[model samples]
Target: MILVEGIGPLATIQDLGRPGWFDSGVGVAGAADCGSLRLANRLVGNPEGAAAIEVLLGGLVLRALRHHTMAVTGAPAPATVDGMPVGAASLLELEAGQTLRLGLAETGLRSYVAVRGGIDVAPVLGSRSRDTMSGIGPEPLRPGDRLPIGPVPPAIPIVDVAPVATSTDEILTVRALLGPRDDWFTDATALFDGEWAVSTDIDRIGARLDRRSGPPLERRIRDELRTEGMALGSIQVPPSGQPVVFLADHPITGGYPVIGVVVDADVDAVAQARPGRIVRFRPAG
Candidate 1:
């Protein structure tokens, strides 16, 4: 067992996510940057889809009740065990009664911490992921919460550290595929031509962006789009014309038109983009 000593604004347990429930209005709620979560789990000898803790902007402290091996991945953050500094993406052994502290991230926005065994939380709808939008699964972690660790695997971790990107580039280039509603806009090319700035309006649901140049996309068909299933990375354009890129906790369906969908390879970069960061989209081929 591990005790949560402190927590940041948003921290929760997440796995690969609950899929195939969108028809029932359940969104796939999981880690914002799943690649990082997978890497952390790998470093701790856990299954790739094991549930782990997702720390937003860092600032988490955990006290171990028993000995355990752990790994921290995703956004680069200062980590320490009993006041001694430790490296991120590397495996570390924690003795009983030791406290682990994760500091604020210098570059990305979300971080993942995985133990030798995955977090043994009760699953909801085939997932341990907390869906902030739907209020499903466990609630956001808080101080004094005790987390149970699953049974550790017998196999040893193969690697000491995992190589992963830590910084968001000066201009985040997200590759996108033109969509089912591309014809709704007067000029879909404008999405690639103009630079967009990540707005403060970002959450698990979506990241709202403001186009730095060019006019708001004018709909060729002014009629509203019927509600349809929305996918992760769906770039929905609302009446205001700003593009909102759906993320892990996006609604199952949306009424707005989706002009493009960010490719799976580039979705992790979108999760790292901070407010005011410049974003540019390119056609995916």
Candidate 2:
């Protein structure tokens, strides 16, 4: 069992996320860096789909009740066990009564902590993922809360820790494919080749970007269409002509015009981006 001594500004338990619930208006609220979270789980001998703590912006302090193995991955937070600095993506054997601490993330915006056997949170709708958007599972975790951990054999899978550092500069290049409603815009090329600035208004639902160049507001289509299945990286442009790149917590149905969909591979970048970051989109092919 793990007890939360200090709940960071943005910390929550997440797994691979509850998919197949979009029809019910539930967004799959999983780790922003799903790939890194899966790898951390595998490294700690836990099920890849198991729930882990998705630490946002860092500064989380917690304690474990039993001896366990753990791994911290994604976003390169200054994570450590029992006050001792530990490298991200590396495995550590922790003892009972040990405290885990993390500082502000230096590179990426989000980091993941994978316990030896994963957090044993009750599954809701077949997922332990806490969907803040739809309130699917338990409410966001807080300090003084005790979280359960599963038991596992000693054959913990060990992996070589290769730290990945993505560019945190103002301009981030993201690959995308033309979207479902691409034809709605008179010149789709303007949407692709243009440089967009990540607006101050950004969150789990979507990141609003200030487009430097695109179809003039005068030429925008104001017709609202029926709801449709939304993809993870859909780049929707509202009537204002400003592009809002949808992320993990985006709704299943949106009335705005979808100018493009960022390629699946580049979705993680969009998820890790903080406000004021610049996003440059290019064609996948």
Candidate 3:
């Protein structure tokens, strides 16, 4: 078991996600930066889909109740065990009563902390991921909460330190395929021509982008469209013309027409982009 000593902006237990519930009106809620969480789990010799703590903007503190192997990945948040510095993407050992602390993220918006056996939180809908939009799974972690660890896996860790590319660039490129509704826009090419700034309204549901230096995405069709199913990474544009790229907790359906769908592999880049950071879209093919 481990105790949450302190928490920062946001922290929640997450695994790969609860998929296949979309038709039932459930979004696949999980770590925003899924790649980072997977890497953290792998480094600690756990399955890639093992549940871990997703820390937003860092500043999460945990106290160990038993000996455990751990790893921190994503955003390169400065981490320390009992005040001694520890590197992200490297194996860490926490003895009973030892305290682990994470500082503010250096670049990205979220971080993942994975233990060897994973967090043994009770699963809801076949997953341990917390859905902020639908209130599924566990609530956001709070200080003083005690988390149980799962039984140790038979397989041992093969690597101690792994090099990972952290989110450090202020301007990021995200690739997407145009048009399930590109024709609705006056000029869908503007999405690739303009550099959009990540807005402060970002959350697990979506990342809204502000037109930093270009015209807003003007839609030719002003008539309201019937509600349609929305997918993860759908770049939905509302009447305001600003685009919102759906994320892990995005709604199952939306009224707005989607101009594009962000590439599945590139969604992590969108998730990690900090407020005011620039994002430039590119054609997928």
**In order, what lDDT does every prediction score?**
0.90, 0.79, 0.93
Q: Write the per-residue lDDT of candidate 2 for residues 1-285, one digit (tens) a residue.
A: 888898677788889888876667777877777887887888788888888988888888878888878888877778778778988788877788999898998766788888887888888988887776776776677998999988774555857575565564778899988868887777776765657777877776778888665444233445767867778889887777788888777788877778789887888888788776777778898
Question: Model 2, 73: alpha-carbon shift in Å?
Answer: 0.9
- The total of clashing pairs for model 2 equals 0
RMSD of 3: 0.9
Off by over 4 Å in 1: none
TM-score of every candidate: 0.97, 0.92, 0.98
- Ranked by TM-score, the better of candidates 2 and 3 is 3
Q: Which ten residues in a row have the lowest lDDT in candidate 2?
A: 213-222
- Ranked candidates, highest lDDT first: 3, 1, 2
Better of 1 and 2 by TM-score: 1
lDDT tens readout by residue for model 1, 1-285: 999999987789999899989778888889899899989998999898999999999999999999989999988889999999999899989999999999998887898999988999999999999999999999899999999999988768999877765443688889999998999999987889879999999988889999897666778989978999898999999999889999999998989999999999888889878898899899998
Off by over 4 Å in 3: none
Error of 3 at 164 (Å): 0.8
Decoy 1 TM-score against native: 0.97
lDDT of 3 by residue, 125-243 (tens): 99999999999999999999999999999879999999986544778999999979999999998999869999999999999999987767898999999999999999999988889
lDDT value for candidate 3? 0.93
Task: Using TM-score as the measure, name the better of candidate 1 and candidate 3.
Answer: 3
